[model samples]
Target: MKTQNQITVTQIETIEQFESLREEWNALLFQCVEKDVFLTWEWQFAWWKNIGQWEYQLWILLFHEDEQLIGIAPLMMSQKRKFRFHFRWLENIGNPECDVSTIISIEPQKTISALLRYLQEKRQEWDGLELMEVNATTTGNQEILKTLEDSHYGFWRTKEEHFYIPLMGNTWEEYYNQLSKNMKHNLKRRMKRIAEMGTVSFKKYSGNSLTWQDFQTMCKVSEKSNFPDLYKSDNLLSFHKDLLEFMRELGWVQIEMLFIDERPIAFQYGFLFDNKYEDWRGGIDKEFETLAPGKLLMVFSLEERFKLGLRESDFLRGVYSYKTDWNPLSREFTNIQVYNTSNIKSKLAYWWVKHLKPIVESLLSKEKQKEQQNDSS
Candidate 1:
């Protein structure tokens, strides 16, 4: 056990250095107040391997005390061009693919405060910061923003909504009854029509029992669906294949498939981690659209999750009418951007592009339209 006071920060610059910290990194994950699989070492490393562009430099921050790992800020630095200027900025490693972002540690306030002080001291190193998919409600990521603001860090933020289902009641039927009358009727109708098509069955693959053939089945279903291009990309397929394999070893991967007459029509790719089941992605066959196989599978999947006594079933990102129809709870997340005001170049760039440029462009557009109207008169 480590005494909390003697904390030291180490910057991980190379992949080998990052790899060396894996054992302690994962151990810290379970000890954190918030359990997010996105912050896991495997997910972070996999994202870097498959999707991270070559130009970005790794700057993962590791916080330790007496040889025991306490916190991590899995970050990277890159330069971006915006409105005639290029500036360097830091951000969490997982982007575009990751939904929940935060400093992975037990005492978030203490960890973030120290990290901020470190950043403030080394302010010349970067131009700004942009962290996305921060669950402002849970994770206490607001602390990061607050700490920055208190230190006069120039930043902006925007929020988006994420939804989830909280399974209630001891029985699946009881939980089913809580849905709106319209939803209940729709589910009953879909189930009946699907049943009439042929023998209907649902299967779930988890752990090492999952195979590449199962992935191919899921891709085939996605290919035949409304989103035909969803699974068409080789890179995405490879990323998912690699991620699924990685997650399986940790016993966090789960895939659900609905078959009619032994033919796969709908499939769901999800993760069951730490008693929370996340309905990550799924696809449906267009030929079975009339039978509503997708909806049927979703209902079965939710029921299955409820039977397993999971704490919550998350719909993940993107708000849709169907997600709302399920009548689940919601969480709001924000994207935070912090400018390095201490650096003259970054300060000028931030103020010019983010503040002055937008207002100037809007006024200029309005004036141009006015001139045309006056000439017509």
Candidate 2:
């Protein structure tokens, strides 16, 4: 009913504006081409409340025609300090924690062009745009990058390996049989060993089934594990606790724990969104490393995922030896840095980072290698 000229693009700058748009925002996400649990309103809002600082300015873009919300670019503006220079940059609100970051849009190309044009109008406010953790295999994201190039946006990309398991077959047993012989035997042997040691219990908590106490237990296990000490920070703990509560309300969260005689050894925190089970974060107490509790937990979780008929299980970021053991298909995630070529400072910084930094890194690497060689001699 609305013409192209009737469509309006508005910038949401305050949390109040963001909250009021939640229903419509989620509705827009439901129809988006790229669907992930991280893109939800709950996740975005929670991230802003917990991880996001007051210094960062919110720059969420919303597009609507005939009062019907169509697209959203969930972004924020922040200052990046490098070598005594503070450069303003635009980035997605949830990063480092949220994987597969992307805009929520059915028409990605059109929406991206409009958002970019809007950004250009306010070019003075930011020196660059760093779109990180983009799933490289996604056609929509590829088109967005191409559009940026066609529009003469000065940008460069770096990639890292991302992995996921594509579920197949009518039953879990069928899928299990497809694994390599060594993996199959090892898993069975380890599980059997665990059973012999003590009563092994694998419990999965979903939705209302999970409680704050259960979450705390998982956190305790993570504290004892070899994973990065994210829980040690009160801010991160608060963020996750809040995030878990929000996701639980949506029936989107799942927590898996491996218990040996009621003592938790390993824990996996994940989400079920759009029929896919995504592995968010996990930890295994190294004290039980010889028992291979982490691997046992994963095996139990995979079997549960199969029973649930989930489409796939994404291990998210990082390429670990255990992930390779699962034989997951990989999708590369790219970090895109777009500079405002019109700005002198932005141009200089981009050149230094894109050109000079790599050369310096290579030289340093060679020197380190030589040092090691000389030490051995």
Tens-place lDDT digits, model 2, residues 1-377: 12245656898888888878778878888876677888998888888877775657998988776576767888998988876889898898887677878877877776787777777778888888887788877788788777876776677888888898887554777777878999888888888888887899999998998888898889889878886486877777787788777888788988999999989999999899999998988889888888788889988899888888888999988889988888788988888888888788888887988899899999999999999999999
lDDT of each: 0.81, 0.83
| Residue range 95-134, candidate 1, lDDT tens digits | 7778778788776777777787778767778888888887
RMSD of each: 4.4, 2.4
Model 2, C-alpha of 142: deviation from truth (Å): 1.8
The positional error of residue 117 in candidate 1, measured at the CA in angstroms, is: 2.5
